[model samples]
Target chain A: MGGKFSIERVNEYLWEIPAEGDMRVPARIYADRNSIDFLLEESRNKEWNALAQIRNVARLKGIQMAALAMADIHPGYGFPIGGVGAFDLEEGIVTLAGVGFDINCGVRSMVVSIPKGDIEKRKEELARELFESIPAGLGSTGSLRLNFDEIDRVLTEGALFSLKRGYGTAEDLEYIEEGGRIAGANPSNVSLHAKKRQLKQVGTLGSGNHYLEVQYVDEVFYEEAARVFGLSEGSVVISIHTGSRALGHQIGTDYQKVLRKASQRYDIPVYERELVGAPIKSQEGKDYISAVRAGINCGFANRQVIAGLVRKVFARVFSTGENDIRTVYEVGHNNLKVEKHTIDGVEKELLVHRKGATRAFGPGRREVPEKYRDVGHPVLVGGTMGTFSYILTGTAKGMKDTFGSAVHGAGRVKSRKQARKGLSGEKVIEELARKGITVMAHSNKGVSEEAPDAYKDVEQVVNIMEGAGINRRVVRLRPVICIKG
Target chain B: MNRNGHETLEHTADMGVRGWGENIETAFKEAALAMIGLMAELDRLRIKRRIKLECSEPELEDLLVEFLNRLLSQIDLEELVCVDINVITIERLGGNYCLKATAGCIKREEVKERLLVEVKAATYYGARVVLLESGIWEAVCVVDI
Candidate 1:
């Protein structure tokens, strides 16, 4: 419980945990009053609270600035789901838990020329076709069966490998974060077991909150930004939510042991064993970063392949050309990146870790693609299966306050079991059907567990982000067909 | 010592599994079973093949994590949908703890029950191994989905 910690309100949308105990800096949280109240109630019931995790992160060596939690903050393994922290490149450390097991787990959205009315007419058929074309659920394998050498290429090349193999075109890579590939990826640093697990799972959509949804732009909040991103009212789009599959999971498992040992060798104090970290300059740290970058590449490749499959399904179902479907942008939520930022009037390169949070680089930032340089990066916030998603743009406030990070999604409020107590999968599907939304899932229990009521109201979450001045809403998407794993 | 059994614990985002037994070996086996149960109904799984695994760690908690992660890796790499630990042995060798086990594996095609969730990995968060006053061994851990 959070009874042992002292919390003070900094503003309407921000809260602070003063530097105390082992904390080297203050911990900041961006949330609405209601959300803060919910967090207080959650802390009383949950053994591991998000606030404590934030405080624990502040105690990490060489951490620059404060540990920040976004509007959708929730308790997670070592770092809260919406946790963000930046560490000094020379003296800071990297923790496997801070980046999460599903490394670079992110969202990619594509806008099509089709209208909402047309999509609604063939919603059921489209959902079925998508389910058939794209593999989903546990232990699912894709069409590609690469050997050890080929797997290494994927680890190093990322989406570029998929593009070269004709899964997608070269233009698709332009909008992806880091051009769909991260630097310093070394397949040699990755374990053989991790490569083996990723052999046939390259294009899979692993289950548990991962999904592919067909949605329509119901409203535009920022007209200019929406136009620049090619999003318009009544236009249909497809969003793929997943991560690096078993490849990333294996990397975390492999490096967790290394970091645990490195933490001791470096004499870094670990509040939670899961938060074990190693100095960036240490051998263990270099190995972990190289392997994680590979995992990030795997994630980018997986989403690119899935996007290609979605395009294929759309071309067949709607009888449109492949070129008609174009990618808007792709952003990873769970990742660690080395970026230059001004801290106390000094430009320093810091390794920023964003877990269950998305990078929202503001306008004029070099990281922002040339096309979006004047508007800012597009941030995709996926809601639940039966709810509405939002597209927002980065703000200068976010860059200065939280390193340009935004909430990833509507964080879970209820446990999966609690959501499935009396609800049946058939009832959920029926309810969504009544609301004119088509639902297709591999398992009925999966549908019941992802019921819309299980999560916080995404509208409120996005509102909090807007009020906090971190991200400005550009458009709102209403789901027409949801394909769940 | 208590009887060998396993139970699912509630977590906000993911889920947890707890297993207890008279010995650490039984506890490990039950913990594996508990995790598999979360994925699919185990009663309907057929034991098609046998897999041998061995790993060692300095701490009991780390050993449990390694053992469970090994089973999870086998499930993904070998396309296993269901599995059961047939025999498990835990021993202390000098400064390290060693674990050896044989698992009964079932392929995806063999599973008849509805698949639930794909557990990503066993995390160190909230992981624990303790001896109760009744002399029973208990292992509790959370798995990322």
Candidate 2:
């Protein structure tokens, strides 16, 4: 019942949804006709109206240049999934919706020194052993039992705290964004309820889309970059995708109420109430930011514990130390950062919010770790259980055009209900088993919803990023053992 | 007890009401019934308290999510159980839409067993209301324990 959206081909791979009515900045989408067609189909069904939400986000206070949507954009709370937007630090607003409910929900990829043959030799044992050792399912608690004091340390230190606890190595911090910790985290700002939830679930894999997969380097696209990331063809790897579970959800709910009143106080006329936000400098905004940063640390710490479990599983199965499966890179896709970027040819501090998108700083970006500053940030794009995942490098073009951000994964194409209607969870398990991929999940629905058929082709999504010069492909990974909750 | 029915629907089994009807309104009504099933007699309750609430979400499914979450919050703050779904609407506003819902609660003496957990709210997880060609509605919602 709305006006038809007109399309303008900016390039072979880019399309623009021009700013017309109340839109302060234009909405730019990076996708070909096939991608856009899939997007339109999702939008037409009113399932993923993220394209419209992207336009609404463009109208946020202090927004910079333009609001961008990745090829994998889907409907989310405030900003659409796979959406990217930045705001000027002095005049900008940090809305919790832009970063999403699951704060710091990102991907962590580990490079193993061993080969796939070694893993295949003990495949079934390794699968069962990993499933039993690692905790999964809803409200699952990890091995670590943190007291209040240690909880405070985790909230403040992020992965570093886990590292000190002997869960991860110092080198693991090298490839992590902000070294597995978002700075300026004040544990005091976190709510008591959030702290209580975080106490028991440090290393747990919470339900709904969270997973731990043992993969092999199936192929290499950029040999030099792959080698730099310690990747060799057929080498084993591990990937963990989750976030600050209940802690982040609690923080999002808490701030939503806080910002609801802050919006009226600050006179922020939001296009949508879900985009409830206040100036970054406001008392409410500052408090929420602190809590969100702590949530990011918890996520980093969560992944660290998962890594430790992986190490233990390997130790029991292969007798090799977990340190051998070194951390390749870790990044939080759903997060907001105060990064300095050149906007309109002037250096400006901007609050960059990436939802369902990864920060892909190209070569020479100061944020890139010292060792690989010469190459670029390792962008981990994970796919569904039965599909292929990729490791890509940030490009200079990505930094200049899209604030150094790239798509996170192959976005979901169907709803969980639709997936269930089309396929049975039991059948999906059998299919994976026949394919030689050992699948172990806490719940059948979890496995079915994350069926490889429910998502867009990761190869296609990665191709879009590479073709757009946003990221360069490094290595491709195929799942060997998958654990889901 | 083949609890496959609970898994078939998107919600957990803590609250009463095994399944919900299709469509947002029916699903919401069924959820209200589900919540009330945890408290006193639904049939004997009168439309005494008419509290209005609204929630917004980016997607229709998320709208169901916010709707349940807000309901849970109200139940916790007011200690009231919704007996009826008077005027429930899920319309798309600019980017997100509002779920304008009205409900009533019965006095304590009129009810049987009290609900176990103060259902803080229903979330987006496993929330579904799909309509079939035969006009049958199927709905599910995972309530917060």
User: Model 2: residues >4 Å from true position, as ranges?
Assistant: A1-3, A41-48, B1-29, B32-145
Over A1-485, each residue of candidate 1 has an lDDT whose tens digit, in order, gives 56588789988889998989878889999888898988887787778678778888898888889999999888888899999999998889888777989999999999998877788788778888998989998788998899999999898899999988878778889999999999899999999999999999999998889999999999999999999999889878899999999999999999989899999898988788799989998899999999999999999999999988988888888987777788899999999999888777788899999999999998998998899999898999999989999999989888888888999999988777788885798999999999988988877787888899989999998998898898999999999888888
> How well does each candidate superpose onto the true structure, as a TM-score?
0.98, 0.81
User: Model 2 Cα displacement at A95 (Å)?
Assistant: 1.1
Residue pair clashes in candidate 1: none
Q: What are the per-residue Cα lDDT tens digits for candidate 1 across B1-145? A: 3488998788878878888898888888888888888787677567898889899999999998988898899878888765678536789999999999998887875663467789999988888888878888899898888
Error (Å) of candidate 2 at residue B17 is 14
For candidate 2, chain B by itself scores a TM value of 0.70
Which one wins on TM-score? 1
Top candidate by DockQ: 1
Candidate 1: misplaced stretches above 4 Å? A1-3
